[model samples]
Target: MELEKKKIVEHNDLIMSSAKMDTVPLKFFELAVSEIDTFNPPKDNTIYLSKRDMFKFLNAKDNDNDKYHRFKQAISKMQKQAFFEIREEKGKGFVFRNIVPIPYVEWKSYSDEVKIRFDVEIMPYLTELKTNFTQFALTDIQGLNSKHSIIIYKWLNMNYNQFEYYKKNGNRDGQQLYNLCNPIIEVDELRWLTNTQKEYVGRFTNFEIYVIKKPIKEINKYTRFNVSYDKIREGRKITKIQFHISLKGEKTIENSSSKPKKVVTLADAQQSPYSQLLIGAFLLQISDVQDEKLMLSLAAKIYPKYDEFVEKYSLDILKKHLEYVKAHSTNIKDLVTYLDNALENYQKRLVGQEKDNKESKPKNRKKGVIQKEKIPDYISNPGKNKLTQKGIEDSKAADELLAKINGDLK
Candidate 1:
């Protein structure tokens, strides 16, 4: 089925605005947002959305009576709800503004499309966003099953995007680094944004269990980053939240361009042995190298170069490149040789792509207009590896080398 453009960008303020919604309505709202042309939204403010598209986007069975009923109910809920409240500073105080996203909904009996109009007042927030915007792929949250999950994903993604932008721009000052790298939000404010204030009010543990934990788990499982949070307590009561977000399989490198330095401290050396085992398991699972003995034997050979792989590309990217190799090559006699060739080809492709992008850009374009490099989706997780390890044994030499490697990282 043909899909609408797979991405949407909204002002960060709007994304971080407070909203209370159920799963279906939130999904519907996202579908409408996806249809919006953020750069040049239609002057009419009314957008026609296909029911078939909604069903497909939600992965629901189309033409089912119960599903259709739920869809209609969601639309009704959206129309009656104040879905967004934009807060801005006034001269002496603050002013709170609200918008009913779908002011009107029109549908005909037995029709496959629904017509809805956006509030004209909401236009400024949705269009002409030059800075402080959150851009994400629609597919990223389509599979999410909770409204809280969707909200948390967008919030975390906005922070991730900000972190990347600051890192790219060389904003390394201590205060700027802290602000950009760590997004510490008030617990009550987060509750307002996620619409859990009433349900989990004054009960941090319950809130964490029902609202925070599940969404973080789902976001990490289905999206690009692994998310965890630390609570800040005031007088034995939680008052703020500090989220720790990181892309899986890639060491959080300080400098974007510099090669990842090896661990150089005793404390850093502790992770080396674990890293080797994880990499070995990842290789075995992805390559379908059946013989545990053979896999361990080859892993031993590849162990010394583990840092090289981590330094050059993320584990996810390497896995994708390897999968590409597996799909394209008909004969793979030697697993080690095949892996080596795959890694080489992958690097070559990246270099070529970067060259092509630069050449395609206008030579006389404005200075400092750097094209943002898109980070690839999280393709696989090392922890998810299900390789059989009946006969495999750790190599003492590999362990020693990895310990040295870890120490070098410091």
Candidate 2:
């Protein structure tokens, strides 16, 4: 299914603005923002949004289950919590703190429509932006699970959008291209970006891992940008960071001669077997940046032994494990790690199941077991070794279907 391309427009200053928001509320806020008509901004702060639309964007289908309650909690939190800090300044006379971006909401259990209001203070930032605004597809962040990743992505978007604007206005030069990287952001600024100045205080290592490294990994892996950074140090202590950014699968400072990779959309996933497993297993979803980079990252390592993988493993084995992963995903903190373990366990089960099936079979059949040489043809499909000798004698259409899948992989 094609997801609606929800474009969000925010003033560059608003993009620079940082706030303390949990991931769910932030997601809810953005989804609501997408509903507003930014060009002709609403006279009133109210926006009517659909619960079905937001749920569909996130692929929240259940095996008969529970995301709506969390959605309710997020809406509740959005109304109660105030932003701790906002970096955007009007005239630099004073700074404001404890601001609420979306201060009120009203909804009914019977209706799918949600009525939410943006704080009147934020109206100027959202409306009638002829200049100094950032626009991007909401899908760029649809899969991002981290609140920090969302904030950092906005930071990257601000500079990158500026770079694109300059290039479009016929200012493409080495110096002009330099606009892609924002100036060195201090550690405090990083915390401001994540709204975690109080929490990660004094624990630089933990902050660096959770607040910096991990979010960057998600941003680079999932978004259109490939971001890198260089740290400025105060003797032994890391003091500041300057980011380097480029389009994913595109030419970069390091590889200017390299060609970009073809970005595969969800529609394209239907064709490639590797993509099918990756998408089907919910390991990755492709909305931006082509290539198989994200698709093949964690799952690919175990997903394949390459072409030999196609012959050895089938989609059924992977799907079984993926379903298991989905069931317990809340408990699985690191999905890549958990998915790797799940795949490994499934492989062992398949091996053991085939062994037991082999032993449980009657060796001498009246119709006879397929000859050793014919084994390859009968079982030439994906999950190649799965067909037992006796089953091979009984199987015809199933054998052909499996053979077709194996052949398609070639």
Candidate 3:
């Protein structure tokens, strides 16, 4: 598929604020907004996208059932999540205004399309762009696998471009070699932005592992900037995060004109001969399947041991080991220890099975023939909790209350 140019403009305040969104919905929003006529947004403020175009943009499967389900799910999430707009007051400190980007999303089973209307309140920030607005190409973020990476890339790009503009206009000091903009954000604020505060609360290590490290790595790898951060602590506790941003190369103008040379997907990786082993390594490192950073780090760690693991175990066996660990382990605090334990358990089970097979063989059987019984498929995921309809509604209600409480506290 040929990559298309999609551009979005937002106020710097909104760009710099805390907004939590999922990968799919965020991508949909970008695609939808790109369709809007920026100069003259429809008077009704509604944006439309056909089912075909949405699927194309997402690089999703063409199967109707899967596409429709995913589309609705993304819309539901976007409707529920709130975006915080940061504002500076004259007398008071910074204030946060809660705004939902799209208040209404409508789709019908009979129709082959979707409709999303920008909330009237959020229109001004999105539409007019005389000043204090950041414009970025959507293609620059297409390669990103996480929402946080996309957000950070945009934030850094905005600031970096502005820094360059200022320097060229003589607004910046002539002696300045490189632009260094440090945005000091509270810990809670960062969590809110990444949508992991609730899941990672009281566990900064998990947050660091999932939110901070991985996204920075992805941004540095896929985008045009190099990002790093310094933790600002408060007497042994990390209270704030100061992100240090700079362009990747010596080129002042960020270029995103060319398409990605290769686009790798999980499905493509799984089909490769060596990728199965890599996937097994990933499963070992993943504390939460949703955390992409852990998966990436796992692959990096297991690269040296690939041959050793491949020689000892087949891909199917390694996958079984992963499934067993995922189903049995409740919490993974240390990934290294967990992987070691998992490997030990796999070896023990293999030895036990071999012994049982040897004992069961008939006395008249061939001298060196070893009959190995096939391992059965895991029939159930015992540890997996199924969410009921009521439970889902209750959870959403609770999230709304929590968001309100957070807003009030601010």
Candidate 4:
């Protein structure tokens, strides 16, 4: 019933879309999806599942026979009420698709297994990913007690995966890169993401408490993401929300993909503009790149952690930190060690650096309201902008980390 590390890979669009369901049905859907051979899906649009395992997954007890009846009720509701409400911007206007995912679920009382068919409308989103997708272990949400936890976890996973992909690929820089980790959203957009457009409409306090804080708290406790949100204000009124997301302990865990991690070589990064500027700037301060032997030696030292450096610091930030590093230290033996140490030290002071702008700004929703800084359009309306082939190839960057837990090559 509680599948062992069963991994689910979903397109980024579906992950970001709204799915409002109770914990039991969500688990049931995931379990069934975990069974699909996505590459070679069922020809007849059907899949068979273990009824006993499904019941066990539902935590139905041998003595508690009422759950079977309850299961029927849930299935009936699923047919009539449970559906994925997907809305995406289509050209100048937006398109909405309501998909009843599993309409055909059948089982005989004598049979140990259940047979079900996925709606053809929902197949492409679930299988055969084109560019963007997210892969995570079902066990990651196994302990989650709420639907919000499940939903937000996937959303965070999608963003974090993109963040890492950019960090590793060395294409993203400036505001474009930083917003991946800390995204700003309109209150309405946040409501859409959580499927709570109706719940806390005018009640700002209640909205902050129930919709924003509680889900984030649950996610922080159960998931790998340590996320916190703050209300942002324009003049006196709070209109937007900013979520600061980072890994709980160390760097975020890699996705549950079976492919080997794709390493971005110094050679590979030479073609990237972000890396070119970074390498050029750092070299101007520490060493000259003209010397081939020394450059090769230095590349060997830094290539291992070049991604880490790129991920954390934009060129502007890195340049400032480099100036500080040069003024304080002299005769550095290990360039990688010195730079990394400086990065950590520099990162620590970044919060304090913001204090320089202490004009005391605004949020009625949360206790800590931040002043309205410039908002990146990407965070406000994600998946709305189409990128060229060279623009932040996250799907290409994270090819290896997209493996399934069961070692299915997605």
lDDT of 3 by residue, 1-410 (tens): 23355677777877776666778888787777777766888768898777777787777766656877787788888888745455545565766677777878787778867788888877777887789888777677777888888777777777776766776776554323243244456777677666665776676887887778888899888777777887766434787776766666644322253211122333222233443332333332222332445444444444324446547666555654555565566777866457766676666767776677688876776643232433223322224645556545644654564444334323
Q: Please provide, for model 2 over 1-410, each residue's C-alpha lDDT reduced to its tens digit, 9 standing for 90 to 100.
A: 13356788877777777767798888777777777787667758898877777687655786426877777788778777746365546685647545678888887889988788888877777786889989888888887888888988888888888888876786566554664644357887788778887887785788888887888899988889888876666434677777778887775543343222222332233245654444433444443113344444443454444334336765444444454555456755554576667656656666776676577786564432222211232333445557566446635543454445445434
What is each predicted model's overall lDDT from 0 to 1? 0.67, 0.65, 0.63, 0.64
* Candidates sorted by lDDT, best first: 1, 2, 4, 3
lDDT, model 2: 0.65
On lDDT, the stronger of 1 and 2 is 1
For model 4, residues 1-410, the per-residue Cα lDDT tens digits are 34775678888778877776666666677777877766877777788888777766666787887988977876777777777778777899979888888888998989888888888987887787768888877667766666767777787788778888988997876455557766667877777877788887775898888777887888888677788776775334567776778887764222443222233333333333433434433333222333334444445555445456546545544544544455466887866677667666655565554453354433233433222332232112335555445333533432322222113211
Q: Clashes in model 4: which pairs?
A: 1-57, 256-403, 257-402, 257-403, 258-403
Error of 1 at 312 (Å): 41
Candidate 4 error regions (>4 Å): 59-64, 251-410
Q: Candidate 3 overall Cα lDDT vs. reference?
A: 0.63
Which should have the higher TM-score, number 3 or number 4? Answer: 4
TM-scores for candidates 1 onward, in order: 0.59, 0.58, 0.54, 0.57
Task: Compute the lDDT for candidate 1.
Answer: 0.67
User: Which ranges in model 3 have alpha carbons more than 4 Å from their true place?
Assistant: 1-3, 63-65, 81-91, 107-112, 174-188, 232-235, 251-410
Q: Which structure among the candidates has the greatest TM-score?
A: 1
Which residue pairs collide, candidate 2?
263-290
Q: Candidates 2 and 4: which is better by lDDT?
A: 2
